[model samples]
Target: MDDFDALSAMAERCFPGLETWNRDQIESQLKVFPEGQICIEIDGKLAASSSSLIMEYDAGLEWHNWKAISDSGYIRNHKPKGDTLYGIEMMVDPEFRGMKLSRRMYDARKDLCRRKNLSQIIIGGRIPGYHKHADKMSAREYIDSVLEKHNYDPVLTAQLSNGFIVRGLTPNYLPADGESCGYATYSAWTNLEYVAGAKRRFHHVIEPIRICVVQYQLRTIRKFEEFHQQCEFFMDTASDYKCDFVLFPELFTTQLLSLPSVDASRPGQAARQLAAFTPQYLDIFTEMAVKYNINVIGGSQFVVENDTLYNVAYLFRRDGSIGKQYKIHITPSERKWWGVSPGKKVEVFDTDCGPIAIQICYDIEFPELTRIATQKGAQIVFVPFNTDTRHGYLRVRYCAQARCIENHLYVAISGCTGNLPFVENSDIHYAQSGIFTPADAEFARDAIADECNPNVETLIIHDLDFEQLRRHRDQGSVQNWNDRKTDMYRVVYQEDEKTFEV
Candidate 1:
């Protein structure tokens, strides 16, 4: 409480032309839940602060406004045994806006929540940008637009990007404020680490995850054993580097069509014959993953499921478990000649490091797929593409980079480099496999972590820092994931009932 005057002055600077918290309110907050009240000092001056209290939170059971929940800023309604940490106020001085002080305060609150064994952190985030759009759209529409990233709110966007999900909207949340038009977004960030009846524990550290992207060379092969031997070589190299995940190029298995027994003239028949290798393909990668103790993205292959041919990518985990995602978008040539059908679902697979998604070839061109995956808690995306021309390869490359920027997640893309003379449609290939990161100071300067030389048969290995990504989403120069306008538009994946709104 000794710094009450400085804090009061800071609040006045943060919320000008509005009511600032008085000395009594500040004292009540510190007296009630001192651990929840946080302040940051820069050069001997208070730069930012956040105040919160513990309470039992049930959205369906309570309809609360800012004044009522916060006891008119006194926080006298604070409950000691509550399961939720309710954020009443967060203020950052205008002079220190871009320093990410707000993010630090949020981290502090999360630490407090874990130490106290709290279930979640709830906040009534103000949509100050709503007032500007009020004449054009309803409050709900404006909020949805922001959720979908169609619009940006100074306060709400940052909160959402920092791992908060919208619960609902609160009307007349703050009548005194004209900026939000007396409205607020009810958001919650659940603590996945929270354990019931457990004591305080130290935060877990997230180490950097290494990825090895193979610019695979396609060549005519004599038999299945030859292809198996080639795969084992790359797996051995990736494991030697202690990489967590190894990615292969899409349709690299199509080299099997180059065999003498296969009829290369009949495109459809050749693809169906390649599908015959699906069982063997799965076996080799599964064996490789377990043998090398590394996760493997076995690239993409044509598989016949229930009489339909679809492009599928497999994730072979080191634990001997396998996950698969079918290619969702089929290209014109694929539909016309290959007779391939599009996939129905977008899925995220769990790894020891974190959750990840796979998009094959043409599927990477669709931004909605990556957005849907990111919303499902995926931290990285692996793209395995095979393009016959440089233009086709650029389409996949540009789209993959865009996904990384728009979703603020790492994207590692690998593609076929050599040619298959005996195969019809797979005769020529072109690619420059690359690992892309978000365009931010915390990441690589060009957003390219590592890339194999164009049209080269080699691999690029790089370590991606998931902790840096977490911090970037919370405090980057731009929070793309958070500033979406969900009230305006959304991308819905019907399979898992997953939705990404902007």
Candidate 2:
């Protein structure tokens, strides 16, 4: 990567002791060892590539290593299995930039998912170490904006746009000065099949709950002004679809309102500027909620008070009152910078559609969080995330689907559209948003168009079928969410006796 020389020069502009390791270094550390790497070539050209790793760390980022894409959201409730994981590093080579390579990459990932059909896919994306310069938002937000438009979610203009779900961001996960590590958001899609040997009796008057998963084909919002415009558009679109509640990605407002031009020399001024911008967007979230008469999950942001930035996910009610969830799990930089405060109670509120619970990005990664949400009588869970690398985002997406199927609940996740910055080897974008419902055989095959896709906006709303959920829980035939062996779960989760053969 001679271009790395260019990156080296720019890096010199920032911190010391940071050097752009030569190709030899990358080869020695990655290519030779190939712990986590995948390449996709279409017609004699590199289309997409991915890589990742696993490590024991409290926070996730390593500044130079791959960010750990762990399934969050479990507040002492999600009992995760073993530490086995697959980290992915990807790039939709310049030749295949906007050609829906994400789906291809995902398909490749799924093939691997099947081969390694252990549990779930975990992508610890831009945890700093893997891609150091992931957060370089130039004063020209348009530069980053350009990135989003090219690969960014661009509103609702992509079919696979439903491929990604936004889980809220990690506290202080997004810092200024071209450096930050965030949690991966999740959106899982599996084939839905009608029960072959099924039984239904008293279903006469009431119809099955109809669900429509829609991903609007829209453009990316590069500026703060565009945020509200897109918001109104989606609100109206959802209304037209007669959907119950609408979803907005985590920190959706913050990304547009963000002022990335703080003087690196003066950290205080930068923090203050970001904080003011955050509040303005918060107000917008309230106004949008009231105007739309819908439930909008305000994305997480830096709520600065007394020099502290808290990672918070705000839920704006139809009445316009805001309910907040502060991210308790803080990455290292978060601890060093703002000292993100712990979140409040995560109780699902009663919405017109059904009972819902909201958790920010990292929160969803923890299976425990979703389990608790399901336990709390929540039929649906809304996760807002600021996903970074492709690997990190998909990890949670697959996990989300598993949770939904496991507990017979609905999970709606909205994540970043690649408007933010990230490390190298990450051509990550949420051009694909997602929705997973009652499994059907047809879905495994015909659900998503088996064709090369471009920018598309469609919804994944389908029938929730409370009757089906009841059946899934009761009928051993499907047993989708009914038969979890808690005893087996403890075998992996419980502490093992340390035996020493002295």
Candidate 3:
């Protein structure tokens, strides 16, 4: 944050009387990606600064101006999952120009590019010398002259000297820059250190990930501390097995309703009271995830947002970051008894192992949701359910298996066992948690990875091989994902109030 003023002042000095990044844009850049924003200080004085973002580069796409590419200098369009590093702005103080600061900054960018395993560093460098030769020659001719040492451009010459190669030219790149006649050179520096066939940004080579599915026993608990202890025990157990993820049953925290203060007879009131435990629920699960060094799908809990109650499942990452998925499909009982509102978006969460999605009990029944999730690169779908009867439990299990077959992905499900007698609609419980895979030559017979005994309070530990899963998706007896005829039929999901066909 302290770099904001220095950066703004430097921009003003570098391009005086021209539009430069403002305070808000600088703040947004720092907040969105601090690692991409670099500054060089000489003896506590700001000498130079540079801004960059990662994006999926497409050479065949039409070029956009600086404003469009950099999101008007806010860099809000930066994609952390992208493979290319894009330089948006680079400035060296006029007094520091001869000190080779620009070269140092470019070297820093090269180091970052190699460290991030990016494919290349690209930028649209201003042709600040174009206006002087506009009438005498065309833009391309001027570029040719500059290449032959007959002419020189301040920015383009510096970029070329720093190992960048000119790819093309961008017109009207900065309409306010009259010195360049609103032209900029499309340039790039390829990362020679980048390895071929390496997994791009935030992804690693496919490996077997161990998962622990907890069939939580819905017995009465006297206090939140007891619930925390139970949760920590499973976290400890999962960590002992070196599992990457631990899945819990949905609404397992409803055991808090067994307290004297919560009245299950008034379901709506009981749900609101249960929602009050959200803070503690998040704290304990997040702490457990970090302390045990394991990712935790802390199950679904009733949470109130904007005066509406929604059942939201949280992914407590081992790094202390939290991701969430709201249960998009609400059952009749949930709506009638608890007044739970349906969530609007289905999302895939990124993990060190790969990408996964959480589908609450009823959500798995809707094929569109899981289809969308898998289409968005989810390899595993975890369903945390709380079904009160055998029929309901079978519905979840069957649908989950079907999703695995049709999507060509893994589905792991767990549910609450025992009984929460004090909770009205949640009194009786039935579940047989299992991890399922597609029926193929490479998978287990009957397509079942592992299953726990029905209605038992136990956890199933199993390993999922992603490399085999990928091969199965590509070379299996049948390719369900690839065989989808999107031209004829498609599943669409609504995001940010916009419908997008998957």
Candidate 4:
């Protein structure tokens, strides 16, 4: 409404004779409810505009035309506490039409619906391509043709892809709507995230993200079925608690070496034996993540790809997509006893909560690796570790704590607890899973959010507030990210593509 002139002009250009709003009409609507008026300006010029009003939804309501719903184009009958958002009009500059500005406007409308806790968004969408086939088919037949892929209507097709369902049709809705041929499709999109009794509310609180760490107990498995059930039990427990991400400890798959036929005497032989199950291992975790709709860091599994053994962590997304991050640094035992090769690259996975990086065991001890990951926009670092002694466990634990403080983000550590007496390389294990945070007043003073009792097989669940971490980074006692002396010293990866200037 503030840029009514620009919005009107753009609408006129986009739709020459198709019911463009004038100053008085726009002013009156804005006066009634200014919350529904939105305009986007790109480069000091108005590129798009969306106008809306609110109304109660009737389950058995008849199809409504634009004039009837808008109260003869004035929208004076808008209900302030309506449960549904009634889209009045949308306009985009001709120059920005093909740039997906309509989709952006639709996204904004859906967001507004959720913000207002509206039940759904209802709109009479114009079927612009109906006129071409008007003589042979009815409005309902035309919509069916478009749905069956026999014909297409640009407006209706785009709306359907944006989650709008065609409820009914109104013929001769707007007689002057030239492109639509006086026909409009009744479309509505329901907000599935809405709660039944929830009222319209606003909050700046970034939702608390919950994380679960699996203190996997090492034991011999007679069959892969047993391993699959064990994995599912942990994931189901975490998902029941509504944890966003579930993590497993490093080398947890080594328990498969306990099978009777596998030669588990030598470390190299055991790695090869585990590598044989890599395909089944991946399928199990990937399916688990998809079935449960949770992000899974399936620990570090040994893989023999192209005849080279590489220790890698697989991240499975809730959408059934998978990503792998290799251990960038290797230890002496890994190379000497297992013939393992180090990965030269690090990777990060993106989730709805935030971006995360997986640094396996020894790799977490290297501060530069975590630093690089944070520079690449990672908000959390997950360390899947395995240690045979308390000393080795402390090395990973202390370094992970330091990384969280230095990077100003959250860190989750998962490690194996029990010992595998029969398997050679997995003979002994000792660990405690813990979620770490920056050492700030707002966080746990000890930097440990939650931890399992030492040498116990358990699951540690903790809630991490990324918003609080962000606030700490912005105004905490010491801001490491902002206060870094990059001008004096910069750590650059040798194989990094970008050059660092210091």
Candidate 5:
């Protein structure tokens, strides 16, 4: 029944004369708005059909005919992000009419409206059986009778029972239908389950969010108890500020090399040995996230998995759920000196604040990786970097700024500030943690949400209003997210199943 011939035939049979759409017209409708055209089949044959398109509610405000709203049932004025779902047409096979097939179709349309988060559904109900009552009463009187249940109409009665309220009567809505001298009724069904606030905010959610970026000083850990206390200190400080998310620097676990059993002079050997403490590191973050009631990006760690050593970040949720994202791009020194294996995927972490991604150190240098993450619904990209010099630190900082501008999303950078003199690779660290926004009038004059002093051990926290960002995306002077040349070029990713693994 999805074929053009079958669909056109069904329409011709259900609605004769000018009311029926031709094969070419049905094909055109499907091509333009495929989601609007829906068909229900029984016994492998089309039993009923319903079509709809998202449109502004104002267009459905008056007593306009179906052709005025939809392009003669083709739905030319469809808007993908509109707040209302406009019903174009609904037809049930004559043989299946009494089986309540039309009701099922209406239910399906309502389900679609809910799934799309539309505020309401509007339709121009045809008075097919009104021609007989035209002389006794007008279109408005006929509709009122249907609403009061004193009289029932084939189409209008069912609409009333399905929770629709008549707004007004339209004249000459369908010229071919001699019913009541060609008149229709404008009806609307408000979604009872519609979410109250944010869903209606320009189709973008408006939430209050706060993030904390840590410029942590590296220290020698004689025991796991000392490491636990340090983590609690950081978490409590950010939690006291009511931060929704707290981010830490990359390879912060290198402090574990201070254990007497691990060699502090050899970085690679120390990192490999710290693998044994990975479980404890994760447990502490998990506990902290739940205790502080916030999302925590516990920085990146070097772990040996399946005989391959790679850098990975751990995200702990307030609900005690843990997720992981591996560092896809590896630095030359990581390959040469550490013999570290690069990760294969970029993963997006979901939090109460929003969807976020973590790109460890050198991974932030690659624009495509962060772009892919943002395309997957990441509103923020957290970079956990461990740089040994001012030049290396600047590389991460500048690239982070560019990533925020290019992706048009918030970027938080946290780095290790102090050095672990006893540890080899952990020595001579430099950093200035900061949260950055897209450089626009809606943001700060400097594009910096919050920042810590360079080479200092401190936490930088700032509140981000989601509504402001949502508005900026629409009215920004340079809308980077919406100004992409998608028709000419697209961002395509190659295969790497390991990169997205939790």
Candidate 6:
């Protein structure tokens, strides 16, 4: 007991300005700050001590509450949170001075900051006295060395350290001996990114963004070469309209796939009739694009490649060259139309506007296909439709909207507008297409109104900014989608709907 008292007296001799608290006061403070303070007992006596508050605000002292107002918006999260301050108290017995118990106290405080999410620790660093103090080595230098060894950056200078910078200065008015050189405050904010990155951070985005978008109206539907003499009129109107690229519903001009007359005997005849439209359409689209500086989507139609038919869409760029004339991602439904081999790989191509992706009617229904496009950084996805019935039309539009939300991309779908008569019912379905955002997906869908009210086929055109998409990815709510923990539960698909490949 006497040795502990002697050690406390010795520590006071070392940190001369430290308050020489009576044992009763120290015990009282320690009781109140049980978790906040650490004490080293030597020979049944407290020899060294440290204490701190590990919170965003000054939760320890009443005087520190004033800082909370200064940093109101920060904790409120309205403004940028400034560096957090940890006022750590350290006292070491002079007998243990050679062992450097101050260094140990400083290390414990740093660990507190790390575990509690505090970025910095502020020190009421020693202020020089009027007369030279007898202490040869500075407690500041020792703390700096320890902090440096632990990889803490020196951001604040207190008193007179070259590497240290001052955050705040207090007026000199010491109640003890009435001595007061302004108390200099120094801080060391924690660096956590390096630690997190070293641990290998990964982002698991399960659902892709669904982008709903559309292109402008096209004007060349009347000149389908059905009347050869109308070619002059068609070209004139196309040029007058300044058509860069006009999307015609696939197979509409020739009525190819939906034709009742198509049979196995003369599949070659159907191929010839379709090829007849492309050369003329492509030439006009290519010329108009170069002249007017615009792009045109030649909607999905049968392409005869090596005697095997493939559903394809051509994107003609204004450079008189083409971009991403990708084969449509085919579904079983398309097999009946042209007996097309499904396009084997996903495709996204660069254009002046953005990376444009094309997915045919049925392809838009699959989320992974759209996810593949989103992951590849596709901004605008072009959807072209040919319908057999209204049975699946609503499903198609909903899937397109889902794609826009999940992928955060734009979708432009051109639907087959004209009526096709089959069976006893003249069933025709129209997809109301538009662009959707994370904020605006529901609004966009709500704006569609009832199509049964006899509205013209919807054509929505909007310049989708890439920045807004980035912001949505950064801070937007996941709407519970991102909460999916795919790593934990593994659900096996039934045989009818297995999505994984063997």
Best by lDDT: 3
> What's the distance in Å from true for residue 399, model 6?
0.5
Scored by TM-score, the top model is: 4
Q: Judged by TM-score relative to the true structure, which candidate is superior, 2 or 4?
A: 4
Candidate 4 regions with alpha-carbon error over 4 angstroms: 1-81, 84-203, 496-502
Q: Candidate 3: worst 10 consecutive residues by lDDT? A: 197-206
Each candidate's number of clashing pairs is 25, 100, 0, 0, 3, 25
For candidate 3, report its TM-score: 0.61
Question: For model 1, how does the per-residue alpha-carbon lDDT over 129-247 read when each residue is reduced to its tens digit?
Answer: 99999999988999999989999998988887678999889888888778899898888998877777665553655658999999999988888899999998999888767689999
The segments of candidate 1 whose C-alpha lies over 4 angstroms from its true place after superposition are 1-206, 496-502
Name the weakest run of 10 consecutive residues (lDDT summed) in model 1: 493-502
Estimate candidate 5's alpha-carbon lDDT, on a 0 to 1 scale. Answer: 0.81
- Specify the poorest-scoring 10-residue window by lDDT in model 6: 70-79
Tell me how far the alpha carbon of residue 226 in candidate 1 is from the true structure, in angstroms, after superposition: 1.1
lDDT computed for candidate 2 = 0.47
The parts of candidate 5 lying over 4 Å away from their true place are 1-205, 495-502
Q: Kindly list the per-residue Cα lDDT of model 2 for residues 134-175, writing each as its tens digit.
A: 455422232234235532332112212424332222333333
The reply for model 3, stretches above 4 Å from the true place, is 1-206
Better of 1 and 3 by lDDT: 3
Error of 5 at 207 (Å): 1.3
**lDDT value for candidate 3?**
0.88
Q: Which pairs, if any, clash in model 3?
A: none
Global local distance difference test of model 1: 0.87
Evaluate all candidate structures by whole-model CA lDDT and list the values in order. 0.87, 0.47, 0.88, 0.85, 0.81, 0.48
RMSD for all candidates, in order, please.
22.1, 26.5, 17.5, 13.4, 17.1, 24.5
